[model samples]
Target: MATANGKLLTVPEVLAELGGEVARSTFYEWRAKNQAPKCIKLPNGEIRVRRSEFDRWLESRTEEAA
Candidate 1:
């Protein structure tokens, strides 16, 4: 399900949003490690992340580096 802000993003979309700085395998690794952004598993078994959550997660990472 998409948030009011925008549509839910796929793994590839999330990668593009991050400018492809991280490889797909690495992203999946992070997800497995619970270090990635929040995601939702649809009934169809598809994974998606809300744009707002992704943005928030990115901001948190930036703050962590500060």
Candidate 2:
């Protein structure tokens, strides 16, 4: 569904897009620490990660190789 942040991604989709190395528990741990992309908690209790926010978060973590 399109949110204010545009397309929303499920946690599984996000993990798969990240190459399937990150576990749900790990992602949740990062979320609790405010280290993962910003998420939306729906009425049913499922979480959604905004595509734009995730993109921006990925950009912020980019490193320049020396």
Candidate 3:
């Protein structure tokens, strides 16, 4: 669940709050397509996406449609 400020969100947290519309596999698909969100890759290979960058990406989609 998101906090009131939404300072951080995990992958599942994002998918769950969005009603499971995008599956975990889709993240991989986007990566394969070179369209995944800006991700930080840890030395152990874990990925952490920044909420602000993601929101910017989301907002750009809206601007494109305008």
RMSD of each: 2.3, 1.0, 4.4
Evaluation by TM-score, superior candidate among 1 and 2: 2
Query: Candidate 3: which stretches are off by over 4 Å?
Result: 1-8, 63-66
Candidate 1, which segments miss by more than 4 Å at Cα?
63-66
Give each model's whole-structure lDDT. Answer: 0.88, 0.93, 0.66
Q: Give the alpha carbon lDDT tens digit for every residue of 1-66 in model 3.
A: 233544555667556755889898997688779676666666787665667757766676664434
Q: TM-score per candidate, in order?
A: 0.81, 0.93, 0.66
Question: Candidate 2: which stretches are off by over 4 Å?
Answer: none
Candidate 3 similarity to native, TM-score: 0.66
Highest TM-score against the true fold, candidate = 2
Q: How many collisions between residues are there in candidate 3?
A: 0
Candidate 1 per-residue lDDT, tens place, 1-66, comes to 467777799999999988989899998899999999998888999889988889889988874434
Q: What's the lDDT of the predicted structure labeled candidate 2? A: 0.93
lDDT of 2 by residue, 1-66 (tens): 887658999999999988999999999999999999999999999999999989999899999999
